[model samples]
Target: MALLNQDSDENPTPGPPRTTEAQYVASRSALWSGVSALFTDGRGRVVLEDVDYRPARLLPGGAIDAGEAPSLAVAREVREELGLTRTFSRALAVDWVPPGAPGYPQGFPGEVIYVFDGGILAEGDFARIRLPEREVTGVRCVEPALLPHHMGPGNARRALAALHARINGTGPAVLEDGRSISPTCLDDLEVLRTPRKPQLWPWHTGPAPDELQVRQSWGWLFSEDGRGLVLIGQDTGSACLPGGTVEPADHDDPARTLRREAWEEAQVRISDPLYLGYLHDDTGSQPCARVRYAAAITDWEPPSLDEATGQTYTRLLATPEQAAQLFDWDSQAAPQLAAVRAAREELGLPAPVRQQLTELPSHRPIQSPAVR
Candidate 1:
């Protein structure tokens, strides 16, 4: 039997009293609900179904029956929808939604979407599949990169955004125009479109005034062995520490941002970051804010690039002495080196050997006569 096959009109014994907007507008009380595996192939593509030709596509899964467990509901739904018997490894996330949200046509007061990490066991998983054509008109696997293109209005879009964020481990939902929608309190929703650009040094100017660019700075402290400190060099010819600017959607302790950035940029895992002082610099016109930390390398590895960017690099650690020398000679490496050294010494490491680079004035003359 299909999970959650009952109709709304049935009004099966009411569980909890239907919550109102006033109760949950600023409250933490949330309904307990469950959704099935936004099942992805090895390539991480999720299965989507078009319902009754609705503009919005949906991941297959449904609410848990009274007294039924969330994980059990997930497994049952997967079997009924995709004809696959699977097991749940763990619950990934419990999505909380507000009451009376106008997104779902079913008039669901709210939902607590529990995502389960699951896997199929047998080749017969694809056999004997029967889709309820009235409810599920069409089905296909949608690559995460293309989800936004197929997403419809309301809860469907929100679910896609949340799932995408969970899968990619990156910022607010990235839209087709490259715009991003960050999670926010309802009061702050109005400012979602306003771009917050990072302050940069005058020499670092390139993005237009209206373009949204955020500045992020972090320390990349490494020991002599290439194992302790991790760094990745981008094709843009800029050497940056592993972290980036903080976003509003980050829920972990702010310090986690340091570790998160390190993993993303250099694919190295950082733990126990010692708090360091913050730095402020201006690229002539733009202001940049940097939060520094001294961290121990609990684990390290080579970096991987997301599909959005094709550039790649290896992670390497260098001694303080070597770092100072290398940074002194390379223009791009100089500033990052200084920052890392300062952080290391603050954490009681040996004072880094210092090498100085002489600043040179620009040689190109302004307003030169054009050659015919």
Candidate 2:
């Protein structure tokens, strides 16, 4: 009966006997990808979504559905999440994040993320953000510096890379594990370190032109070809423009203060410094207003050891895009730099060449006390 029967007791009817050994799985990788946007408002603050599940924030995107293109996925996400019917900017960055990458949720189902540039949204556009009550709790458009505070390290690095790509006019920046693999990445990218000293941030307080206490001066220096000059500090390894505090003896012109400091520190003679704008230094115990000037640098002298910091300053040349990256990305100096660029453009000045990855800091002047 067993030999004649079509179905056996141990084996299912008309099928091969089940094996005790585990079924073989294909030795292939199933990587999932998604698209996100670095949406900025007129003020240049990036848009982030705060979720209800965890404290970590995220860019406005989700997993790429099967049979969907990345670009299409981003457009869908923005429309669904932010309720905006729109097109996406060029792909600003493409990152290959492994499973369990920082910024991904538990059960993150992907190996790559495509970050797109969602060009600056006006204030009206910012007000248009409507969150899906089930997923996101609230939305925030804040300065780029606070990205790390809101999002995970991986997401922050990738977003910054996308910003760099958009500002410098470079193609998508490629990265792995929060570090860039592309050769054009910024030389002084401060992604590797954590805050050693606490910044005394007053939370988006714009500079008070009339109610300032101290006066400091910095120069917006350019080369003959119009590339900007950047100074990298030896002691702190921080990037800053070449300039310093204003003394009572600096006379009526803050540019003279810059000139004196330039000569003393970098050993360069500053040409005529036209005041671009002023930045409020709000990171210290004492708040001050910083005066900025735009000028050309000439007659270089080898830098001496900075007596104050006891570390030697390294002088380097950078383009406008480069200078923007070299400085603190979310500093008040950003507006001054933009003003200088605008004035130059209006005057038909030569444009600078971006030698490496660009950085996009916000150009929107901080309008109100808490509007940043």
* Top candidate by TM-score: 2
As a TM-score, model 2 comes out at 0.69
Q: lDDT (CA) for every model shown?
A: 0.49, 0.67
Residue pairs in steric clash, candidate 2?
164-358
| Candidate 2: RMSD to truth | 12.3
* Local accuracy of candidate 1 as per-residue lDDT tens digits, 76-157: 8877766666776565445565565544556566666766655322234444556764677666766443565676444444
Q: List the residue pairs that clash in candidate 1.
A: 198-215, 199-286, 199-287, 200-283, 200-286, 201-283, 202-283, 202-284, 226-317
> In model 1, which regions exceed 4 Å deviation?
1-32, 105-108, 120-128, 153-372
Consecutive 10-residue window with the lowest summed lDDT within model 1? 355-364
Compared with the true structure, what per-residue lDDT tens digits does model 2 show for residues 109-213? 557889988886767787787777688778887566667888888888787767666656777778785557854424254421222222222222233366775
